[model samples]
Target: MAQRADISVTWERWQATPDGQTARLFHLTNRRGTRLTVSDWGATLTSFKLAMPNDNLRQLVLGCDTLEDYLQSPYLGATVGRYANRIRGAKFSVDGQQYKLIANEGENCLHGGEIGFAHQLWDAEIIESIPAVRFTLHSPDGDEGFPGNAIVTVTYTLSEDNNIRIDYEATVDKACPFNLTNHSYFNLDGVAGDVGNHVAQINANQYLPVDSESLPDGSPVSVEQTAFDFRTAKAFNQDWRKIVSDQRYRGFDHCFILDQNDGSQPVAQVRSGDEQVVLSLYTTSPAVQLYTGQYLEGTRGHNELVYQNRDGFCLETQYMPDQPNSDCAEECIVRPERPFKHSTTFAFHC
Candidate 1:
């Protein structure tokens, strides 16, 4: 782990809202020529710079200008948690006991309730370079209508192999539900427009469908007859716009139960236009939430302001949501004694 003082740490004030909430940006760059910009506001990774095979220059992640835009930008390279996805009814039962969570996403608790990990000022330190800058935060018992005081650590590592690896570890003092994921809206083509043209493939045969409120129901179903079949390279927009009338989301936003024999396996691989960019995902988490930026509103990224169902996408790695209260979970990860550890690496290639 990289230590706080080992790397050059610099801080800059981004902006302050009229309500007194302010956003601070922290820059952590290392001797390896890697640069990472994170905001204390949400423990959010505002910018990630990396070298491209085509050019010696570093590239900026999908990002927008302005603090309001930064805060509003759900995909501004941030690790969201406590519980990353939705829990049905804003309540779940664990160990025969009932617990009510903060209902932020309609009738459900989406992403650790309203003030999920994305909306916090995390305490951070650069662990002196074993290869990560660890961001730590304490989620007090019942902070978001959930239980337990959980200590969470999210480590960002820029490996020498040109891989950006994210390692998450958390431990709760009590039994509660927890799932974490990074909500980075990716536009492999640099926000030109619509991932409809990109080729993608997921190693999942079945996926969990949700009700109108985006809550997963019952067991995993085959993606066979539906537009969810992503077992091989398929265009995101090709099937995204073809969802039936009954589906609530305009685009894809569902969890695909992964076939993990040993955890941390390749769940999906994405290829951009012209095969200029290739991205692969590896995770230990039981599920991966594939979102096509269906509800992405406003401007950002390389080409133009992102519109609904426009540029950008997400592949979240984590356990099944609503697992705390439902038996529908493929794997219930939250435990009192075991240390919850999840590692996801995004390998970028030409």
Candidate 2:
């Protein structure tokens, strides 16, 4: 029989929040020298150090050295929830009742309002059998103007095959909108430079057209003969010059409707400039938002590195944004009988 990988997990006190809550970190490592550090504050992945060629270790995600840095931007490497994307006008009608939400992003509710799951304190437990850390949170009724009392759980599992699997489960007392996703900005070259030469291929023939407000205007449009085309592997920077010249939007902030919304196979692939690393994304969600971090500024990251636009990119796998205002709003409903369950896996190769 094949021997199991020498995987082990260690938990240590990271710091204490101003509210007197204790925050901790869970460090997981395998025999192959791959290491992952996750914090209990928001079930955040602080660092993902993978073994590279020439006997080196590279941190694949953007992180900070102190908790204060995380407080600056809660979405960095954190799990976002309740509703992963935006809701137009900060309001949505559910069962004939118009519910108003906290408008954290201008006139819209972005990423589950101001106090999303990414800023919550979660209870963490290490599962020895699966070698995973499970985080649970209980959001009371009327939290952030959301209707239901939600009990949510997220599991972060690292396998010997160099795959990071994230499993999410949630149940609500009443019907509400629920969508969850991880916001991890990736720099496969370890933040060496801008991700201009990274090659990407998304299994999507069409992409959502956004309005000036960055919300989906209507149905998806074909990527054929457009700058959004990524059906085949190609350098992302090939057509970036023209995109930047347009004044409507800067970098990528659009969602691609996956050819297959099922989680059966990988829907996208990204490779480093030197082709030394590869990242594959698989998700059960219907869409994946490709954000190029255009507005990233004034934020400091690992090793005192200054982050700028295009420093990293995000592939947030989740349901379509502004669903309640869209044609397929029914897909966003989550009831007691129909709990929320989704899985996304990011497999790395070096």
- Highest TM-score scorer: 2
Give, for candidate 1, the lowest lDDT window spanning 10 residues: 301-310
Model 1 earns a TM-score of: 0.87
Taking all chains together, each candidate's TM-score versus the true structure is 0.87, 0.96
Model 2: per-residue Cα lDDT over 292-348, one tens digit each: 777667678988987877778899998888987776887878999999998999999
| Lowest lDDT block of 10, candidate 2 | 241-250
* Top of the candidates by lDDT: 2
Which residue ranges in model 2 land beyond 4 Å of their true spot? 1-5, 244-249
158-255: candidate 1 lDDT, tens digit per residue: 65555667888899887776787787776677644667677889988889887667776677899997899998788886787676473444578889
Alpha carbon lDDT of each predicted model: 0.72, 0.86
